[model samples]
Target: MKKTLLGLALSCVAGAALANDHDDRWMLSTNLIFNALDNNKNLESDFGLGLGLGKFLNENWTLDFEIDHVNVSQEGGGGSVDQIGLGLMTRYHFSPDSSLRPFLGLGAGYLDHNGSNNAQAVDSSDFMLNLSAGLRKEVTDRVSFLTEVKYRLDTDDYTGTASSYDDYLFSMGMSIALGAAQAAPAAAPIVEPAPQLDSDGDGVSDQSDRCPNTPAGMAVDMYGCHQVDGDDDNDGVKNSMDRCPDSRPGAVVDADGCEVQVVIELQGVYFDLDKATLKPESISILDAAVKTMGEHGTLVVEVAGHTDSSASESYNQALSERRAKVVYNYLVEKGVSADRMTWKGYGELSPIATNDTAEGRAKNRRTELVIQD
Candidate 1:
């Protein structure tokens, strides 16, 4: 009986340590034990039932008091014993897996043992020191099954019982978690409405209504302005909606909504090596220039040529003029008006960079296009 009470106290401590929060709590447990006597004396096996109330002091400790009852029988007769014990138990959880918790507890408790004449009883009710080792397997989130082996050191006293006893107990029980497990109040979802403006009944809002003076009956985007279609120049017919995106006030425009005026720039360079003929790559560059001049009917272009300082002055002058005329003839072949194009050559006299290095000489030999507006 002393051992059974000790085991209950230990299991309670284990439960308290495994529980989620620190709070005073109660647990009820039942165990079946096989009782044995010290000197090989035959003793009846008994069933033990225990109920414990414990307060969790912290994660690793608990204070528990338990009541236990055991009924034992011999061949002839049997009786029951009731015990009440109070203990302070400490538990160490050796692993994070809550399902299997192994712990040790050492506690001192006072036990009052009362038995009928038919049952073997200790002669005294005294203070006993208890040590227990136990394991709990969590069957569910809130409950567990516990088993323990315990030793109780009953300081011998008036009852005249042995100094100590051992108990092996197996029990099934549960623990209740305190905080997060409780039901929570429901919350309402939040909804936000779209912004409404343009409140003044004009075509604009108080904010960003820069065109508050905007006339009515015009379409608008979200910012409260006249709906702008393709107004690339912001003249407002939107290039798609505007008949002439680039037209000056009162200027004539073609059917495609573009002004008839043209502008052109002849800007690029060519290299002279081993021949006076234009290279195939230079022909492609001049083709692009010609196409640009054709797109704008009234445009005029000035083609300027430059030469490096390696040659005699007159020869370099003639070479520069030949390069300039080469581009001019290509543009004319592509149907640019001869009256609107002029070609000029500035020989090595107009060197843009030093000719001492190959790279500087390359830069000094060049062609340029100046647009005549």
Candidate 2:
């Protein structure tokens, strides 16, 4: 029953050790023990003490060396004897959680035994080995109470004795964690913003300002100088710079800042009802659009969403806008630059197809990706 209990305790400790996240470099510990041994039909009991110094390789494992002093008395023996020995030990933690730790150690050393009658029996310094298992219960951030049981084997050449002796020791100890050891933090790479370039004496820098060529002395925002009431196409570019000012209201534009292409038709496309989530089948269409944009790096794209006539105009407008924004966000999340895209929604007001038919309404509930070169 005792052996079974010990086994259960060890298993629990091992599990705990596996769960603790320890990032430390060194550890030192000491133990006070009560030892007992059985030889043939006789039982011997003793009081023992040991001290250890250890270095931690990581949070999970440590290497240590220890020395012990013990005093033992046997039944029917005339006197008590004392012995001292030294050995090496090691421990391993199995996991990343901090509550419990299980460890194991092995050691070998020479023992010198001295009896009270001034008779010192120095058998050619014999060897000893220990097998131990224990758990450490953390009481606080830096300290823990440990309990362990060890089976020790001692070699002897008592002239008439045929075999060696074995002993069992149960120990309870408190461990103070030495704080010098810790894991290094991971490093992050540094990023520098792109440099700006400006031509044409327009106070706006080329990197951000969409309108690079501005007239010599007009008022301008960060981009460049332009007239306030002169946007013929209402495309945000003023008449002074809008080359195709009378072009259709929603035609896409080119770099001389002129309307150049009209959106004639959209290929097969479907969006979730009142939502922006792209279905699996729609992914290939979006991917193709991205590929098109990649081939023309200087061409910025505007993704606009439109909805059918069934919904309230205001709600449909907002939903349509969200659908367009979702596509834009997905592109950026997939590594497209935010500066290269624009998004808007027209709801039922800008439907390209008649609202009365199912096929026409399906076409109205669509997203259009327009390239502005």
Best by TM-score: 2
Candidate 1 TM-score to native: 0.37
RMSD of each: 32.7, 20.4
TM-score of each: 0.37, 0.42
Any residue pairs clashing in model 1, and if so which?
123-159, 124-159, 219-227, 230-238, 230-239, 231-238, 237-242, 266-369
> Across residues 1-373, which tens digit of lDDT does each residue of candidate 1 receive?
6667667755665555554323334443444433332221123545566655554443345455655555544335555444444455555545432458787867666756556535555434666666768886656434557676656565434224445544443444555433343233355588785464665456556574644655667666544556545556543335544555666543434444555543233444455452357766677778888787778777666777777765467767887788888878878888898998999888788876665444566677788776654
lDDT of 2 at 328: 85
What lDDT score belongs to each candidate, Candidate 1 first? 0.58, 0.65
Displacement of residue 192 (Cα, Å) in model 1 is: 22
* Candidate no. 2 TM-score: 0.42
- Residue-level error in angstroms, candidate 1, position 252: 53
Runs with alpha carbons beyond 4 Å of true place in candidate 2: 1-25, 40-43, 116-124, 158-160, 179-373
